[model samples]
Target: MTDRAALQHRLEQGIATLGLQLPAGAVPRLLDYLDLLVRWNAAYNLTAVRDPAEMVTRHLLDSLAILPYVTGSTLADLGTGPGLPGIVLAIAAPGRAITLVDSNGKKVRFLREAIRSLKLEGVQAVQSRVEDVQGQFDCITARAFATLADMLGWGGHLLAPGGCWLAMKGRRPDDELEALPPGFALASMHSLAVPGLEGERHLAVIRHAGAAAAPAAC
Candidate 1:
């Protein structure tokens, strides 16, 4: 059995280490989400990180590491397998409207249950290819989803004018940056420090070429 209290302590410590001041009850809600993910992951193999304690740092903190860069009232997470940053973001920022998009049916089902179980008000799950998702969002996130070129190529239309795309990557994607399609430019790149996690974690902040640039440092 997973030790819920221990997991919650680890998550809380990580949140403080990141210097994030979430709203009341956000911590417990995040822990609840973690528990749900762990339970669902057991049978469905939703994520590679099976240990709930490891999920605190690998999943929760890794996702929350990008919270500062996420802007706008509406956000969409593309290729959101098992609702990594999508659900985590929703729990942290209750005011923002978040949509989780994925093509995998099993993952979508888990996302739906997560939303229901968490009682997240402004969150929704959509099972559709990233290219086919409708409507525009002020912010879009893609976590190791695809090559930057192809990710922007397929989901470019979904980012509203003046919006930004937060691409979660393992390292600075120099080659992919060179291949960004027309009308898009690299705004900034942030080296994320996710507590208890090793290896490189980078957040590539991209925006329309014509749009005002995001703050240079994030």
Candidate 2:
């Protein structure tokens, strides 16, 4: 059985560490999502991380680490397995139209159930390869999805003008940065310090090369 009290305490602490201002009732809803993930993971193997306690930091806190950098009115999380930051973001931030995209049928099934169970009004789950997904978004996020070049190559067209693509990676991908498909440029890169997470994590912010340059994110 999962330790609900311990997980809640830990999640609360992690949110505090991230300095996030989540909407009311967001915490309980996050735990609900986590529970759903845990139950579904038991049979489907949706995520590699198995332990519910470990998931508090690895899955939940790790995703919340990027909350500060998320901007714009609409967001899409490509390759969102079991809703990672997508469901987490929809719960915490609220109001933004969020789409969780993944090519795997089982994963997308989990996402649709998550949205329905969580009562996430504006969130959606799309089953498609990133390249085939339609419509532009003000913000795009791809976590552990693909190399910078490949992600941009497949989904770069979905980034609306003046929008940003937040690519989550481990080490700074210097080589991949150079290979970004012709029009995208690195606006900023922020090193993320996720509570209780080991190793380095980086979020690369990219925009159209023609857009006015913005200062590096801290």
Candidate 3:
């Protein structure tokens, strides 16, 4: 099979394993986005994972693994290099408004192209630091961006009242959870299982102490 075909097959299997019900044509669009990333990465060095098959597993699947926990109509992905969950989530949930924030000019340029080429509505790529990003979102996502305390310290203001912060980590970070900055509380810690991926993956769900309570499971 050709590389795209093989990647499509693997993506289908992975989405099935995750039990996600995506809209029609979503998978194909996602594959096309991956193709763009691969093409851009050749010069920009976007991601370390060069292989498209591995990108399906490590980037696409890994990002979509958090779909179950994503709620609300607006989301901001801080430090969204190459738009991991940001771009992927925008494709999966086109109705929601997604903002991909990154300080890197090259990555932001790539993100803008992806948004334009994909014809993705309600999605914008902002070239700015996490702290400088304005507007509160109902949900915020950060993938290995920084420690829980640090992420909150920088982008905490961007989360709307009652909004939730979903931080993706490689392993359970008990220490970071313990050191959570004041005014924020740990809502939950979920162990994520990305299909075909080895090693530990965890999602730290956090919320403001004064914010309204979150629904169960997020």
Give the per-residue lDDT of model 1 (tens digit) for 1-218. Answer: 25888888888889999999998999899988887888889899999988888999988999999999989989999999999899999988888899999999999999999999899999999999999999999999999889999999999999998888999999889999999999999988889999999899999999999787564432
| lDDT by residue for model 3 (1-218), tens | 99889999999999999999999999999999999999999999999999999999999999999999999999999999999889999998789999999999999999999999999999999999899988999999999889999999999999888888999999899999988889999988999999999999999999998666687646
lDDT tens digits, residue span 1-218, model 2: 25898999999999998888888899899999999999999989999999888999999999989888888889999989899789998998899999999999999999998898889989999999999999999899999788999999999999999888999999989989989899999988889988898899999999999897542331
**Clash count in backbone of candidate 3:** 0
As for candidate 2, its clashing pairs are none
lDDT of each: 0.91, 0.90, 0.94
True-structure RMSD, every candidate: 1.7, 1.9, 0.9
Report residue 78 deviation for candidate 2 (angstroms).
0.4
Question: How well does candidate 2 match the true structure in TM-score terms?
Answer: 0.96
Residue 71 CA displacement from its true place in model 3, Å: 0.7
**Model 1: per-residue Cα lDDT at residue 174:** 95
Comparing 1 and 2 by lDDT, which wins? 1
TM-score, candidate number 3? 0.98
C-alpha-based local distance difference test score of model 3: 0.94
CA lDDT, candidate 3, residue 178: 87
